[model samples]
Target chain A: MTLFIQQLFDGLALGGVYCLAAIGLTLIFGVLRIPNLAHGTLYMLGAYVTYFFLVTVGVPYVAAIGLAAVVLAVIGVLLERIVFHPLRNAPHTHHMIAAVGAMFFFQAVAQAIWGADFRRMESPISGSVTILGAQISWQRIVIVVTAVIVLGLLTWFIKRSIHGQTIEAIEQDRTGSSLVGISPSRVSMLTFGLAAALATVAAGLVAPINLLAPTMGDALSLKVFAIIILGGLGSLPGAIVGGFTLALAEVMTSTYVSAAAGEGIAFVVIVLVLAIRPTGLFARAVQR
Target chain B: MLTVRGLSAGYDAVDVLHAVDITARAGELTVVLGANGSGKTTMFRTISGIVRPSAGSIDFDGRQLPDLSADSIVKAGLAHCPEGRHLFAKMPVEKNLMLGGYVRRRNRGRVRELLEHVYELFPILHDKRHQPAGTLSGGQQQMAAIGRSLMSDPSLLILDEPSMGLAPLVTAQVLDAVAQINRDGIGVLLAEQNAQTALRIGHHGFVLAEGRVVLSGTASELLDHPDVREAYLGV
Candidate 1:
């Protein structure tokens, strides 16, 4: 029972990270209709930016995270304008190809700037506590709490705020949005920026628990795609629930079965979800 | 307030709208009558800057409209209520209306006033204001769509096939709302397939066929014209 409780906390911590990752990618897909194959690369770059600010520049941890998010946001905007915007009218394949190209190009830039060595960051909150015979790291607790707050705020913004409804408006009907004075281009830029910022914040929170590498986001990207697919694509609540579901599934599998099966859970999820409910668990009925 | 001369536009290489000349004056409801595929939608798309005119010009209140973006055109006070009644289905009715007022969002008080005015015009929308726009009945959806356009406080409102896909009574209700909106001092450029009804409410009318303006006259004249009577009114 104690081990199970410990694993649950572990799963929740990882779930928080997974939710952040899925939210960023799904939002861009939901609004821009671009799958953003390079999203993981953005995640990796975010961790590196956070590391540079906190360690190299000696900035305070919170300020470092904020700066990193801002930097990633600007990078995201540039990527949208230079790559995605040009391919907006192009075939879907072209957007994927461009994203893959961007991934490779940005990865090379990171390798040159930071080197390919595996690195890790030290968190400000460095301690552990025991509750109900389960030990939990403060950092992990922070991750879970912060993720909940951020997502809650995001939900409010999208649902209640005027600027955020523009995103929802464009997602529902592009032509209608234009007719009513919502600028798709401007919204696209803002979506990309916001998604990137979310990614940075997630990476900053989780990097202390894991090693940082240029390839860190690659596997996570696949996991995030699985999450969004499991949750209805572009559905916010779907992503959140799917994130925790996948994380818990993997954690339980790894503890009870082989670790290899844990790593393969994403593939299992993709296959099962595709076969059973292709539109995902929360997908609205297809519009006529 | 809005003028188009020799405007041509199309998807890819095929032109959908040929050098179409149109004029919609301030304080008048100008109706464009056409059959399916007669380029009424394409013309509206061009006027609203959704499609770039390959030739000629679109001038609105002395400003060249074709040079602006679609959203900019809305900001310039020309609102388009598109043919399909494309309400953001997943969003609430009030959110849809608020998004329409996004351009003038800085004036929170006026937006609230606009919301109240729209509610007064279509009380059903206010009753269903918290409901998803997609869930509304057809007539109520049309009312919401029109209310959304009005939220932008447009000087010239262009409605495309506002009566499409509704029961006769609902169509009359929606058209009646359009007439009410026009009477409130907003210039209206209406496109419709229902000629007799449109002409009855319009100050003047233009008949379009095969991407060209086939006829133009006062509403009563077009209502009496043999060509319009035969082609559109099915008299």
Candidate 2:
């Protein structure tokens, strides 16, 4: 029973990371209607930015994470203004191609600057807590707490705030939003910035445990995509459910089944959920 | 007041509206009547700044609006209630209404006042204020759309097909609300395929056929015209 509880706690910690990544993907998809293929690249960029601030600039680890998030948000706004804005009304294929191009461009830039080295980020928090007779790292607790706080704040904003309501309006119908005086372009920029900032937070929290490299986010990106698909394309609650579900399933599979199979569990879950629901587990039946 | 002269618009190569001229006066309901594919909605789209006019000019409240964005046009006091009652489905009815005042950030109190006024106009919206807009009936959604437009406190309110896909009783209810809206001192530009009902409440009416205004006159005059009766009024 203790073993099961330990694994569950571990799963929750990992799920926090997936939730952060999935939130970025889902937010961009919800407001922009474009599946941002470059999202993983932004995640990788966040980790590198944190690394530069902490190791090179000699900033405190926590402050580095905060700065990285702000930097990534600025970068996201720039990308929105320069690349995404002009292509707003363009075909889906065009935007998809641009996202792919951005992904490659950012990855290449990271490789050129960081030299493709697998670097570990030092944990800002040290020590462990005994939870249900299991020793859990403080860093892991921080990750889970951060995810809960960010996701909670996001939920409140979308549910209650005026700008958040405008975002929802734009998501439902862009032209309708415009008719009501919500500028789609400005909302798109804000959504993109928020997505990038979330990605940065995800990276900052998990980089200490996972090695940082240009390709570090590749698997994480695939896992986030799977989570979003399982959750529902644009449903925020679905992303939360899907993220934790995938994390728990992976942990359980690694503990009981083969460790090798644990890596493949997310994809399997995504396929199974899609086969059963098609529109995703939480997706509404109404076609947009 | 709104004025459009020699307006031409199209998607890529095919022109939808060609050199269209229109004028809407203050405190009057002006209905643009046409069948489907006659560029009725397209006209609203152009006026609302959704579609860029290839040539000519749009003058709203003595300001040229050819270069303004849709949001800017709404901020300039012209609000459009688009066809199909495009309320934000997943959002609550009240939130959808709140979005109507997104451009007028300085007048939040006025926005709330407008919300109360719209709720007074359509009591059903107030009852379902917290409900998701998608779950509402078609008539309710139409009311929410109009209510949202009213939230902006627009000087000129434009609506497209306010009677589409509605029962006669529901249509009458929607038209009555629209009539009340016009009576409140706001200019109204309405487009509809339901020519008879639209003209009944409209102060001035224009009959559109094949992307051009075939006739324009007082609502009573157009209602009595033999050609309009035969072609549109189903007399």
C-alpha DockQ of every model: 0.91, 0.83
lDDT of 2 by residue, B70-145 (tens): 8889989999999887788878898888888888768888887898999999999999999999999989999999
Candidate 2: list runs displaced more than 4 Å. Answer: A285-288
Q: Measured with DockQ on alpha carbons, how good is candidate 1?
A: 0.91
In order, the Cα lDDT scores of the candidates are 0.91, 0.88
**DockQ, Cα level, model 2:** 0.83
Candidate 1: tens digits of C-alpha lDDT, residues B14-55: 899899999999979999988899899999998998888889
Q: How do the residues A1-288 of candidate 2 rate in per-residue lDDT, one tens digit apiece?
A: 778988888899899888888987888888888888889999999999999999899899878988999999999988788878899889989998998889889999999999887888778789998888888888988989989999998888877888877777777887888888888888888888888988999899899988999998788889999999998898788889999999999999999898979999998998898789878888842255
In terms of lDDT, which candidate is strongest? 1
Which residue pairs does candidate 2 place in steric collision?
Answer: none
- Give per-residue lDDT, candidate 1, residue B176: 89
TM-score of only chain B in every candidate structure: 0.98, 0.98
Model 2 CAPRI quality: high
